[model samples]
Target chain A: GAGVSQSPSNKVTEKGKDVELRCDPISGHTALYWYRQSLGQGLEFLIYFQGNSAPDKSGLPSDRFSAERTGGSVSTLTIQRTQQEDSAVYLCASSLGRANYEQYFGPGTRLTVT
Target chain B: AQTVTQSQPEMSVQEAETVTLSCTYDTSESDYYLFWYKQPPSRQMILVIRQEAYKQQNATENRFSVNFQKAAKSFSLKISDSQLGDAAMYFCASKGPSGTYKYIFGTGTRLKVLA
Candidate 1:
């Protein structure tokens, strides 16, 4: 089976610029999630989508961060006006559903705000 | 809100030895799931083991096992006969029951295997 995949393994951008990270979840996966991991820090939850229900944006750090899951298969995380503090590895994961199932993670996109 | 904690920043164990990584979480929900994820230098997260709060028996996979104490809110991973490939960052995570399946992860513990 194909695993979760992310694009632009490494991204370098200037401060205040916007960046869009893409994620392709496994086939038939109905749950997708985005998280950020800073150096020496834990994985910070960003957003989550379950089936066609409303996406959970409670973990979004700010309004500048947003995500959209199109057709319930792919998801894109956009960071508008990125700041230096936003430099980290953006990870995406997908699951079959809820039900305490294991979440498969992608390689992640390392965003560097210079 | 739920929180996961890994008290050890790093740990080292010799090959073929045993090592345990400690994890604790704070959550009001009684029924949830605890997981141990391993991230190697390649930066890919892999599911190591999982324990359901409702089950009293611990979860074990090959040489990897978990000592889950629901009452104390503690979940520790024990690796017996550790191998070099086991060297990686171990993270403890918790997923609340139903609703959104977002995972709350710990700070992670770096494990080093020595020959």
Candidate 2:
């Protein structure tokens, strides 16, 4: 539990169903990031939250994808009407605000949409 | 936009032997950072080594070291005395120290240690 913790290590859901993934960042870390890693593909940035000063949602793939961080700690990524293509390993990472600081990552949530 | 590229999809090395994983990136920024991360079966993203653009000296961490060529925009990870425990997927990433600080990762190279 010293590292970033993610909930629902694995999730299997049907298409058109909604799913929510959670992330608990390391204590005192102010920056949290979301990324998706599809099979054979590099990790894709999703969203970024830094001390709750308006999250950088620029990486959200579509309007249906959104995320929020409360208390500058725990965060959730929601996917509405999920599609098969949305299946991937959702990774959460946290880092100190200082640039060049290493980012600590969670085990990630494996999502499968059928 | 910044991009990282790992040309090798897979690589193998005999136990105790040395191996190198190649990585390249495209970035116009003059200042930034490059990193190599290892993901074992446990799925933890561990930082193997890092190099700063401003520093001309390379970085070494135990059995892991990096060969950073700033002008060529290449950062390669060299593993010495490879161990079976070293078998994992290694990712090369880059991020500008300023601005968004969003890391751009490569596809990764799957490393295997033959015992």
Query: What tens-digit string does per-residue lDDT give for candidate 2 at A1-114?
Result: 498999999999999999999999999999999999998878899988887578888899999899989888999999999999999999999998655378999999999999
Under CAPRI classification, how is model 1 graded? Answer: medium
lDDT of 1 by residue, A40-87 (tens): 999999998999999989999999999999999999999999999999
lDDT of 2 at A109: 94
- Which run of 10 residues does model 2 chain A get worst, by summed lDDT? A94-103
Global lDDT of each candidate: 0.94, 0.92
What DockQ results do all the predictions give, each relative to the true complex?
0.77, 0.67
Which residue window of length 10 is worst by lDDT in model 2 chain B?
B94-103
Shift in Å, residue A33, candidate 2? 0.2
Separate clash counts for every candidate: 0, 0
**Quality of model 2 by C-alpha lDDT:** 0.92
Worst lDDT 10-window in candidate 1 chain A: A93-102
- Candidate 1: the clashing residue pairs are none
Relative to the true structure, candidate 2 reaches a TM of 0.97
TM-score of chain A of each: 0.98, 0.96
